[model samples]
Target: KPNEIVVVPGKVLGIGKLDHPVTVIALDFSSSALRKIKEAGGQVMSFNKALETFKDFKGKSVRLMKQ
Candidate 1:
């Protein structure tokens, strides 16, 4: 699911088109962020790869975590 690619780095460029949305988990935060993640049709997951991170997205769709 390339379209379901999750770009761990927060470096997004407008150089191409991705029919599939990518979830960008960043180490930084920005204002008016809902527009960025929501507009991309992707979610902004924070530290989900960590042990206690699952608690953040418990009610949402999450699976297949890799270390």
Candidate 2:
């Protein structure tokens, strides 16, 4: 979904492309990944900040991607 938030426990790489804009929260991100995400009009943030911002994300769906 466009408004959906994707959280990654590890680092996000730039091997692939994002089709739509979304929010991404991860422990860390590669420099190229950050640039790609921004180019795709997505927002990226740290996991700690995500937790602080989305306190009510308990029922939301989260898919973990393995690198």
Candidate 3:
């Protein structure tokens, strides 16, 4: 799970729960959304960080565009 990364834009709601290192980048965030990211021990990186990290990928199918 070395390359595992999560991306959330806008807001992250309670669809349920997740136990992973998800990096959230949004124009804004809700308190609930922020809590979930921290609780999961994930990082709340800025959009810039997201883009930079994505570029360091090794054949990732997912597309991450700069903001």
Off by over 4 Å in 3: 1-3, 52-55, 59-67
For candidate 3, write residues 1-67 as lDDT tens digits. 3224545555555456757756565556666767876788766766787677666656653334243
lDDT of 2: 0.82
TM-score of each: 0.38, 0.81, 0.54
Per-residue accuracy of model 2 over 1-67 as CA lDDT, tens digit each:
7657887878888888787777888888899999988888889989888878888788776656565
Candidate 1: tens digits of C-alpha lDDT, residues 1-67: 4324343445333343434455555544454454555666766655555335544554544334232
The clash count for each model shown is: 0, 0, 0
lDDT of 1 at 16: 37
**Residue 13 error, candidate 1, Å:** 11
On lDDT, the stronger of 1 and 3 is 3
| Clash pairs for candidate 2 | none
Q: How does candidate 3 fare on TM-score?
A: 0.54
The per-residue C-alpha lDDT of model 1 at residue 41 equals: 74
